[model samples]
Target chain A: MRATVLYAAGDVRIEEVPDPVLHEPTDAIVRVVRSCICGSDLWPYRHMKPDPHGRRMGHEFIGVVTETGADVGRPAVGDVVVAPFMYCDNTCEFCREGLHTSCRRGGGWGIGGVDGGQGEAVRAPLAEGTLVTLPVGADDPLIPSLLTLSDVFCTGHHAAVCARVRAGSAVAVVGDGAVGLCGVLAARRLGAEQIVLLGHHKERTDLGREFGATDVVTERGGEAVARVRELTGGDGVHSVLECVGLVDAFETSLAITRPGGAVARVGVPQYEQVPLGRAVFMANITVSGGVAPARAYIEELLPDVLEGRLEPGRVFDRTVDLDGVPGGYAAMNERRALKVMIVP
Target chain B: MRATVLYAAGDVRIEEVPDPVLHEPTDAIVRVVRSCICGSDLWPYRHMKPDPHGRRMGHEFIGVVTETGADVGRPAVGDVVVAPFMYCDNTCEFCREGLHTSCRRGGGWGIGGVDGGQGEAVRAPLAEGTLVTLPVGADDPLIPSLLTLSDVFCTGHHAAVCARVRAGSAVAVVGDGAVGLCGVLAARRLGAEQIVLLGHHKERTDLGREFGATDVVTERGGEAVARVRELTGGDGVHSVLECVGLVDAFETSLAITRPGGAVARVGVPQYEQVPLGRAVFMANITVSGGVAPARAYIEELLPDVLEGRLEPGRVFDRTVDLDGVPGGYAAMNERRALKVMIVP
Candidate 1:
């Protein structure tokens, strides 16, 4: 089977890898139907150290179940399904609490000898617990939107949920990546009355406006903070979604948040330390959000996609096959595409 | 009027100062009946730089209204009232959102020429907004508990509230000071089923248990984290009240929080930076809470204190008159007193 592999910085290739097979009674073999490149994947693509064996890539995918182990109770063979970035046993205490990402038996895809999502097939551990069955067929037109449930849309929803975005909420979304754009959509769906998108990209910000951003601030750094504050009547917005994990983005998120408001960070933080100094302390601001528990949110967001109320699939501007995976990485890394979808 | 003043670290004096008078149309002069030395006061007492004019000390008090400016509509002359540590115009947008600490027009007591609580009288700014009138008299037996509503108890309640403590929650408190003790009570009041308190002081831990700690772990650092995780079935607590603001305490709070848990910090963080590294990000831990908005909580907690359902003032183990305030500061600074009550 052909799959994506990272050999070193800026080095991605589609290589033949051994096919995955069910390794545990709780496992199932999933033939990948659709997968995509993620912004997070760019981290290693930019500066990953060289390795002889190489690392499998991708953590998001929607596929059809091809085989199941003896203990697999659901996701019968041939069922169309989507897998969250992490696999987990649904009955764990954390899973029961709707924190599947923290499940004791959970593990991420593409690392520690597991199958990567950007491949022809994946051996999904804890199949019944990890895969959410999709009602549509594998080739359904809604697949693009439904594919987002694997990580992107659910992550944006996580940011809004963590920030407690409500119908009357005023929100500021920082970053213009696919996740940030989805966050604009999530904030709108959650009824945020006012949203300011802080991004310099005209094309992406335009999409952000379509997703319910009432205002756009193209400034960066202190100027961006000033613009956001100006847009929200000098008090800043009630909630801030930090979709960029850079320290600068985090600082801007904190600076533009109103007193007593929340800053939910969905981006994987690039720095080790965060300032929780006198300013943040005195304003009574809250900092929350981490890796989204996509499995927990998929059920709630699926119906919206099926009903045509949400069109998160618009994030995908380019598409590729297994052979074009390497170019897909370059296109996204160079900002030529907002997001690239892969039809395996 | 005599007031507590800090000339330098370890140098406190009760000196005669000009009597406070109404300064703003919204101001009122309150005759001090009860004021207390807070844990935060020790911050300045330990290392304050000498000044030609000493800084005023103290920020918690209950007093009787002596005089009011034309615009002061409530707490008429002779009415007993409690003032939050910071004075805020309760009508401000921040105040209306139940975040009076962030009120646009709010300012802290004992700073910028404002009269300190440990004085004969205070010119309470935003009088109609800052003072919560008590139904009882100055000499009421509930005065001690009522005085707590001014700061200590409300600060603890803020920690619990920010952590989202609810019925059957497993909570851990990381300090045994007045605020942490009050946090135990708050957690109990909120119906947390399992409360683990981390403190080494037997006397304070005893009070913490009385306040509703289901278990006590006296270890520090790694041992403390292990003990807490062991107590909660190796998963840690769902909510952690970080009443100590040191980086070590904050780190422990993060370490012992269960995945997807919250750490509410009410302490004045002594450090400038906090680590939000991969460990915290992957666990989906939330770090929230800040300076308590006492005015917003006073009304909700007053009824409970009035009915003897809470006895937060038990934290005060010593009393001092105006002249003895200097000694009161020493006792608390030396750890000879849990908290000190002042009568002017």
Candidate 2:
């Protein structure tokens, strides 16, 4: 089975790896049909040296189940499914609370000894709970969009939910990445009255508008905050979605969030400390949101995608084969592509 | 007028000051009937040297409107009213959003050029909006309880409200001062099923119990969090009310808050920064709350106090005449009293 593997900084390769098989009653073998490069992957690809043993790369995927273990019940072989970035048993207290990201016995794909998702076949732990079967056929053109349910789309939804977006909320999304663009979609789905996308890239901002952003503030840092305030008539937005993991994004999220509002962050935090004490207490804003519980959100968000009401797939501006995974990373890293879909 | 004045650390004095007179069209002259020393006051009293020019002290008060400015509307002269620690014009955008603490024209009593509430006669800005009239006579025994509506009690209420306290919430209050004790009462009033008071003082904890703390964790910092976690079956409390301004108290509040839960802090944060990035984001916890909008809550809480349903003033363990205001600060600073009331 061919899989994406990282050997060192900027050294991504498609290499033949052993095909995964069911090792536990709770496990299943998923034949990867669609996988994608994540923004977070670029962190290690651009900075740290990959393990000498070669590290498996991808966490976001959509696939067909090739085989199921004895303990698997619902999802049968040949069924198309969305695999959230992390796997969980779905019955742990945390999972029951819809926080599968904090599942007591769960681990993420491609990390912590789990087989990565960007492969011809990968072993899925807790397949019964971690995989959500799509009602649509495997050959549907919506595959790329459905692929987003595994991560970015659900992450965006989590940000909106954390910010408590409602029918009349004025929302600001602080990143122009795929996840942030999806946040515009999610905020619209939640019926936000106005949406502000703070990004400088014309291409991404255009996509953000298509995803339902009512306003675009092409600025950074304090200037971006000023722009958002100016757009919101000086009260600032009711909710802010911090989708970029950078400190500036977090700072701007806090700055432009109106008093009594919230700044919900789905971006993986990169800063070791945040200045909530120096500012938040005085402004009375709720600093909320974290890793998205994608599995919990799949069922609720799937119908919209299946009905052709949502096109999150537009975020996948480029598509490639397993062999082109490295090129996909390059495109994303160079800001030439919003996201890359790898069809294995 | 005679008022509590801060001359230096350990040198609180009852000094002669110019009597307050209504200067603005919306102002009111209030004869202080009941005022209490707050926990925040001890900060300056025990830490910083007061400037040679004496600064006015005290913020919590219930008083009679001795006179009204031209624009004063609701509470006329002779009305007994609870003066929220801060004053705001109810018409401002922020005040309309129940964030009077951030109102454009809002100002805190006893700080930033405003007259202190402990004075014999203090002119209140935004008198029409900042004062909530008491239904009962000025001499009612419940005046003490009604006075708490001016700050601590309402502040605690703000903490619980900001934390989004629900009917079955398991709440932990991370302070033993009057405000924390009031949080116990506030959480109970909001229908929390279980409340934990994280304080070591027997006297204060006893008052906490009376205010409906179902459990008390006496340890501080990490140990206190361990006790709280143990009490909540290792998942942590559904909500934490941070009523202590210290950094340790803030840390414990975040530590003890359950995943997807929140810590609401109404304790004027004394810390410069907090490590929200270390744990909060991963845990899906919200750090919210700030200065209480006491004016927003006073009306809703007054009937409960007037009807004897809530007795927040039980937190006042000591009382003094106007001339003994200096001794009141002394007792509170020395830790001999939980709170002190000045009978002017």
Candidate 3:
């Protein structure tokens, strides 16, 4: 099998690797049809981390099942599936409660010495819970769209859920990256009456509008909060979706949320002290939303994408071939592309 | 009218001020029978801001209505009433939405220059919404317990609501101060079966147990979290009530709360930044709770106290005359008094 492997930071190469075989009864092997670069991948891609051993390159993928172990029941061979970035045993108490991201046994694909999805063939654990099978003979043109259902789309949905976005809510999406753009769509799907997109790029803002952003605030930080207030009659937004994992994004989300409102932050927060007293208590804010339980949202969100009720796949602004994954990494790292979907 | 006036830090004096009259159409004047100095009063009392104009000192009181404006509807003359620390019109959107603290009319009482309850007479605005008429007569011996229903008890109840304390849930109360002690009672009322009182004072711990604290964690900070976790089968308490606004108390509340649980913070977060990123997000915690809408809970909670089902007034460990308010403030500031009920 041809796979994209990272020898070191900024060094992704296509190489022939041994085909994956089921080691666990719940494991299944899939022939990759579509995969993509994630925003978090940029963390290791940009910074030169000294790892002498080569590592797997991707986590998001939509593929066709090639083989299944004895215990794998739901997905049969030749079935198209969207695999969530994280794998979990759905029968666990945590997964039953819909917190699959923190599943006691689930592990992130392509992370922490695990095999990844940037390959022609990949192995998945807990297949029944991790893989959502698409209908037979689905249009291949929608592969890129379905591929994003693996992570960011469901993540955006989780962010919307965290903020407790309700019907006719005034919502603000912090960060104009793909996840934030998807969040605009998620908020809209959740019936947010007014959606504010915070970003500086024209292309992103245009896509944001298409995704149901009613207002745009190009300004950042405190200015962004002021603009959201200006849009919401000076009371700030009723719900804020924070998709960028930066101090500025988190603070902006807090600043623009009204008292008794919620700021659902899906961003993987880096080292930053979030002012909980002044921003949260005095304002009476409720904060939730962390790692998205993609598996939890896949079934509900997938049909919408297939029917064109949502175009979350529009976030994939670029495409790459199996051998062009190195370029895909570079394009995403440079911010020249929102997301890069690779066909293998 | 005689009022407990704050002249300076540590200098509270019983001064004759102009008698309060019905200023607004919805106003009512009350002759205070029982008033208490709150833990919050220690802030201004100890720091003694330069207020040359002087200000009244308390907010928790149960009184008899002496007069009412034509528009004051429910509380007729001679009716016993329990008025909250803050006043709300209860007709605005915020009030309808149950965020009465941020009422649309901008009426909050007993903070800074707002007329306080530690006086011979008090003028309560938005009378219909701010005051609850007690069924008991003027000289009821239960006035002390009824007085607690005005603020601390209600504030504690608000904390329980914010923390989402539920039946059979484990609750941790940070701070053994009067409000914190009352919070223990509130948690009991909310059906918390395992209540951990985080306090060092034996006297307060005894009072906390009396108020329904089933467990006690005397250690502070990390040790307290460890003890709470030990008590909750290593998952942490389902809910935590932060009654002390200090940085350590805030962190302890966050540390001891279980994942997907909440910490209701009622401590007046007097000007400080509460760090919110790693501890909050990684653990998936929700923090809520602020100034108790005493007017909102006084009706529901006062009945329990009056019926002897709740004994929150036991938090008032000391008593003082109107002229002894200076000493009362000192006692609270010096940690010599849990709470002081003032007789005017």
Computed on C-alphas against the true complex, the DockQ of each candidate is 0.86, 0.72, 0.55
What's model 1's lDDT at A91? 91
Worst 10-residue lDDT window, candidate 2 chain A: A272-281
Q: Give the C-alpha lDDT of model 2.
A: 0.89
Docking class of 3: medium
Candidate that scores best on TM-score = 1
lDDT of 1 by residue, B123-175 (tens): 99999999999999999999999999999999999999999899999999999
lDDT string for model 2 (B49-127, tens) is 7698877888888888999999888789999988888888988989998999889998888876678987787889989
Give the per-residue lDDT digits (tens) of candidate 3, residues B1-344.
88887767777778888888878788888888889988988887878876787767788888889899889887899998888777888888777777777787755555534578888888888888888888897677777888887788888888888898989988999999988998999899889999999999999999999889999889977888899999988878879999988877888888898777788889988755667776577666777787666766776786687788777778888888788888888888999998999888
Which candidate should be chosen as best, given DockQ against the real structure? Answer: 1
Per-residue CA lDDT of candidate 1, range A1-344, in tens? 99999999988989999999778899999999999999999999998999989999999999999999999989999999999999999898889988899888889999888999999999999999999999999999999999999999999999999998999999999999999999999999999999999998899999999989999999999999999888889999899999999999999999999989999999999999988887999888999999999999999999899999999999999999999889999999999999999998
What's the candidate order when arranged by decreasing lDDT?
A: 1, 2, 3
Clashes of 3: 2
**Model 1 alpha-carbon miss at residue A272, Å:** 0.7
Give the lowest summed-lDDT range of ten residues in model 1 chain B: B277-286
Give the poorly placed runs of model 1, Cα more than 4 Å off: none
Please identify which of the two predictions, 2 or 3, would achieve the higher TM-score against the true structure.
2
